[model samples]
Target: MPRARPPPPPPRRMEAPPLPGFSEEQFRAACRELDQPAPAAGGPWQLLVESMGVRIYRLYDEQSGLYEYKIFGGLADCPPKLCADVYMDLDFRKQWDQYVKELHEKIYDGEKVIYWEVKYPFPLSNRDYVYIRECREMDVDGRKIWVVLAQSVSVPQCPEKPGIVRVKNYKQSLAIESDGKTGSKVYMYYFDNPGGMIPSWLVNWAAKSGVPTFLKDMQKACCNYSKNT
Candidate 1:
């Protein structure tokens, strides 16, 4: 597990404007994009992982350090609601979200600011992200869906700590649609530029390896969630 820094003086969640003024439209736009599914085939995306009932894709270039990933899969014995609950349980997240070393949050002004640091393997500087998380559910053509959105944010109350690189452009979302049975379909998106320099090989493997592992870990946690609770 990582470390959790002390809570700061109460500050609004995403309202403190990390860059400039962030509007509600931008937030809704992100949600819409994540909810839209990627085309069945043909695109810049390269299939990386196709095991454990999950498929992960990546789009990147040798010259560009920025990386983007689209991960989709079905949990053999997990429901969408259980999966969403586990993902939202910030406390349990630190346990199953292997890369996370520290997780904390400050709530104010009707917004939630999540502060977390992720450990990168040796020689790579540990990366951190401060994202605003929002969850919404709606009925689409009579079927219900749940979406959770998170994007990197900067707040005066939460300053960059020493010894870690801040992921200033991290944006991610998790979308799940229940099938009215015991199963659900999930779509996850991630894009970010880890500050400073990192090897392209490291980036490739993180998408191919890191993401698949995280998905399986999430499913396992869901299986025994009741026991733990």
Candidate 2:
């Protein structure tokens, strides 16, 4: 009998492509922030709202003259893995996030980048952002933690558009883990300065109302995620 080919060398296992600009240090820093206690009241951090099992707070940055927000909450019916999946699902985002006028991913200089254009109320121009983001899961003190972090980056190919305002300064960090039962606990830090002269009132409204609305929408989306996918 012809020599039987040794079982074809075990098929090579494929590995996930590395994130182009991923930084372990940055991811760890975000995790640390998530572990910190909530900012004290009567200080720079002002409580915005506490309802529906969520708390939102904002702090002013003198350098940027903008507000940065910190939010934490529990999702009663959503698991950590499901929450992360729903958040990262760009295709599904378009179907659910009404404010997403345009969103997509592209490659530039061998790095994957995300571009998002958000709708502003009438009379105000739309805003767009180009940023790089990454996510990872880890075990901390026997508890599983999931983190997603993002920051705006300058990309030569993606320049300012005529009508849309470009958000030059943006950063976001999100951490999710078990709620000790059947749900997930969440934490987030976010800031962005939409270029141009936007009224302070409008900005405040967007922040205060937008955050809770987004969480509610996300929860609803999570409920439908399995069926939709």
Pick by TM-score: which candidate is best? 2
How would you encode candidate 1's per-residue C-alpha lDDT over 176-205 as one tens digit per residue? 876557877778888888878888798777
lDDT of each residue in 135-184, candidate 2, tens digit only: 89967777788899888988877898999999989999998987888888
Question: Which candidate leads in lDDT?
Answer: 2
lDDT (Cα, 0-100) at 40 in candidate 1? 50
- The whole-model C-alpha lDDT of candidate 1 against the native structure comes to 0.75
Off by over 4 Å in 2: 1-22, 41-43
> How does model 2 fare in lDDT?
0.86
lDDT of each: 0.75, 0.86
